[model samples]
Target: MVCVFSFFITSCEQNETIEAPQTTTKVAKKRLFKAAKAAVSKSKRTPSTSNNNHAAKRIASIDCFAYVFPITIKNGEEETVINSKEELADYYDAVEIGSEPEIVFPITIKLEDNSEETITNLEELDDVYDSCMGEETPCYTLNYPLSLVQEDFTTNTSNETVINSEIELHTFIDMAFDKDENAHITFKYPLELTLSDGSISTIENDDDFDAIDSYCYNYDDCEDYDEFDCFEVQFPIKANLNGEEITINSNDDLEEYISKLEDYTFPDFVFPIDIKYTDDTLVTLNSLEELEDAFDDCFYEEDDDTICFDITYPINLVKNEDTENTVTVNNDQEFDAYLDSLIEDDYLYIGYPLTVILQDGTKKTIADDDEFIALEESCDN
Candidate 1:
């Protein structure tokens, strides 16, 4: 509804103009005036995404997000972000968009402390109009820069003695924004660290910019997005922390950093509030685009059970946190029976199993029903 009205208004304003009332043409002029006003007024009104044409499309193929503990906010200052907010990802919680700005969402995050401040920055037609308003285009004036107000926060363990504990603060918001421009961003979690111990801490000082918006930028696109000064307002998540503003093209780098975080043992943790996963299933493969889809889509996390991913389905997994104790895909009764039933001469072996010792690379053995030979590793020593 908002996009349609915006398209009508911007189109009429540019092409047709409402002139002064002539003597004889009062009625015709009045109708035109009313239409022009209606268009403009409708354009100015808030867009109801519910009535959008692309709602079904969005539901069909959507982006997802998940937040996990010990999150590191890697973008901000030497400081890190900490979210005890152990959020289980529902399919809807992550973002979904279809067709373009029709179902677009430009997200801005409001911190726990700064709920009072009104979003004066990205809260207008022009804020969204300029980018979205292309002639003969959709003219989707998405309520530029959507905002996320902090609903509430709770600490796992109170800050009496400074002992650390996991904390997960829940935040949710319905937004409207341009389809492009960080519409679905994987925030490098901004987490705070305790100097004394390595335990996750939430003892935060909300003194800095109370609110953080991703689209908080001036109309003018700057050449050097290197420094914070390039933008009008500071974003919730900051890029170019240590690396020389060398922007990462994909979330692969983010996943690499997240995966190898334990190796580096980073000082601070920043939770950008945008974590996502590709699938909700257990047997999932990690891909470049899919890693960015990581929103920790774990169905649930229990205080007692530490098994991170889904454990309901029987899988080839290790027990007691030991990879050595693995559940290999061994030949069961059916498979063994099938193999035994095969004729001895009919069966073919690609390579010698016992002679050809196992190498470092991919080592899968194939055997024929020849002399019953037991295979042993040559490099056992």
Candidate 2:
């Protein structure tokens, strides 16, 4: 109902003097208006692109998981057995437009984690899809010089604006619909964007943009085992990768091992591995279930504070300004734990000229207390 009303408003606006580009078809104009509405709604909720349509299509296709061999699929009255990824792709290619393929229930699927799940119905399949997608992470940064098509209700004119920075982009979006909600902004297509997978996509149309929207940028593409987050797995761990026994000695080794895995497969970790938390506390995970349980709460300390900088490790912390009782902190997790463990009367100070990593990943050395206070204020800005 809401979509119908939004589409009607866009149609009515186009009937006025608001001029679309000469090359844009009427259907294209409507799609652009819809994209504009989506952008406005998503920015209001969170600063990211909307991907509801794209996600639905991906969920239907089971992009992240593999169908177990010998599963049945029906296209109208025709039934067939799909044995491999190649056969499934062929089936999709040959499926008739009107006759959508339907899955034969009580089928099994292989997830990315090498776990097999029995999906009895569409609802169960949806649950598995949600689990496979995992959590939403930070989006990739939009490149500057991006364009937006702005609509002016008062003048009945549509003009394109080029945005050069993140700040300008936010300001323009905020002001675009200030006068009237119907007057919205849409993106000028044929734009180049960097996806979460580090691939460049030429978003030539609304459909192209929608397909890449709200995509979680994976720095390492390690869906379940993210190294940048809270806990660090004590290395020299054993795992079975593609029916081969291998020892992963470090994070690099783990990455190398994962790179060698076949599609829709993951390393089967040999149990009884140790992990160290942010608080510098070590714990042993005896099984995969325990490891998953550990990751359930393994968010980084910066998530709580929204800080813009990372402090360099191995900094000296003095308790109550006593140099004799100074403690050396190696990471953000340990520092956070130390701060939390402090009593009401206890005060802690860092031994300065401390080094810190800024938001842009540059290192800076703070020589005194005044400089540190200034740095904190800078983060607030």
Candidate 3:
């Protein structure tokens, strides 16, 4: 019996030892599986490394001219890409090793007397008056029977010969005058003068020559005189539409001018009318609202108390997206109301890319918001 009890106790001890190791092995395996699952979950929640590096990938730059989309510049090569102006500047600054010289346009001047002179540089125009001082017809005394041609279409135009000074010439060049258009000249400096009554004149520079030119150009009744109180020209006022030149003085003439543009289809955002001012200034009206506003400023009513000068002109309209969409508005209240309806219906907005030939003859493209506002302010002035 003693042997039996000892054997039973040994058996019990062996079983407990074997079971202890089994339990420990199962617990360790469970812990290892849980750790592995937790590691996998944490990895899944972490953001991708590729997403973090997205901004670093955008190293290329782009430039946009006249708000016409952008072209990318990568390693001195032009590429097509959409990029902000600031980004383009940054990329250019980083990669550019040297500066390139600016290219200048060659200019030629044509006088009314069929005398032609080519000016290869801006310096040549500086001493024109001094060079012609002792000649039979001095440059200083010559009227604007002058037309300028430049390799750049922006600066080619018929200008007033009154631009005698270097500063004036530079300013005129900067204005980017349109080709084949009449520009009114207003003097900014006083001229030593004698009136028709043989008395010394009190007329100074900075005076507008519009009234004087109006009488001289529109009427053939101007009297023969050596020099008048203001500047005047007897030349016909003309504008180049495409390649064809048209004479314009009245609303009918302007309508005939617009009739020539009926076959072309422009973008919906574009204002189709090309305006050539009396001063040879060029402006593209982008909206009917702007056209109406300009017209409002141009005309006046005649009453018994005042004589209102006629300033009416025909304005082209964009009615549809077709070539035949061209229509003319000539001081018609119904047409104005129709434009207002279009605006109210959200078919038209007050914004479009405006390319203005500034007073200094430089071409400025106003497409951004700030530029548009500045243009509006200038129009108000």
Candidate 4:
């Protein structure tokens, strides 16, 4: 009886030892899970099922140009009460509205790429301007307050040209659009007498804007179009810009988008997506709980096991796995929203944030974060 009792105790001890590692693993997993949940709660990348999210994600917006004036108004008439830059900064501190006058230039963006673009416009930007005030499509209403409180008066779009006597400022404004000559924009800058005589600065309306190309869009050539047979006439826009030369693949569908906008009319097409489970081996998912009905509709990238790589910006924008969430555009403009991950359920739109174009016309991509505001802060008085 003693031997049997001793044997039973030893067996229980062995069983407890066997279970120890699993218990540790489970506790660690729980901690990790709690940590992940906490992290996601604070992150924008966290996907939610709230109805508010659906309403929020619906894309709606329109673009407009606004002019800023140094003068102030109580009802409508210009008041000379607040003309100083210091006061303007506080009054129109909201980046969406113009407390000061600016020469606002409006742009109509036509999404040439079939897949949804990754650029996202914020609600604060919406307060800048509105298209119309009705249930009709693209209705945000004109006279919507367009202001940028965080940015400086100089960087503000509506702010008239200011000549810096203390320092020479060379800036470039990057304009991204379909490579169409007809897609030209003309606006007279309300330059003060000082800037007109200062340095004879250059105004670049040309599209072959820069050589620091960071975009590569590949598509098969279309048989419908004439095969490399054109009469001797120089099509103003360059076929390609980056280090890589332009190569239109045979059976290409997008070639026509780059065609002359003056005559060519593009069809309104839609892209549909289907969702499926890619095993963890290929497209990795966080958490041990496998996603049931795992994915929302995805584009172009198939083979769920394979990482879905889709372009978000100009051309074939690539999305990699487990990297910093970024939107990279062509390094051709000082201010371009090409790389923004724009998610919306309303009309898409544009808002000019901080801008600093280089003399050489090299463009930089500023992430859609507070860092942009920090840059704007440095320029403010």
Candidate topping TM-score: 2
Q: Residues 1-381, candidate 3, lDDT per residue (tens digit)?
A: 111111211111111211111012112222112222221011001111111111111111110101112433323344325344344334322322232211132444433222456655545644443343323532112122222222212345322223333323333332222211122222323343333444443323222222232332342221222221111112233555655656656544533443343221110122345555556666666564454343323321111112111212243344322336545545435344434334111121212243445555666665544654444345435
- Could you tell which candidate, 2 or 3, scores higher by TM-score? 2
Clash count, one per candidate:
42, 2, 11, 55
The C-alpha stretches of model 4 lying farther than 4 A from their native spots are: 1-203, 212-254, 262-381
Candidate 1 structure, TM-score to reference: 0.14
* Residue 261 of model 3, lDDT score: 31
lDDT of each: 0.22, 0.50, 0.30, 0.23
Per-residue error (Å), model 3, residue 21? 99
The residue-level lDDT of candidate 1 at 162 comes to: 13
Q: lDDT winner between 2 and 3, please give it.
A: 2
Could you say which candidate leads in lDDT? 2
Where model 2 places Cα greater than 4 Å from the true spot, the runs are 1-57, 60-229, 300-381
Give the TM-scores of the predictions, in the order they appear: 0.14, 0.28, 0.17, 0.19
lDDT of 2 by residue, 17-105 (tens): 32211111212212222222221011121111112112111111123444677878776688999885456545543444234456688
Candidate 3: 10-residue stretch with minimal lDDT: 40-49
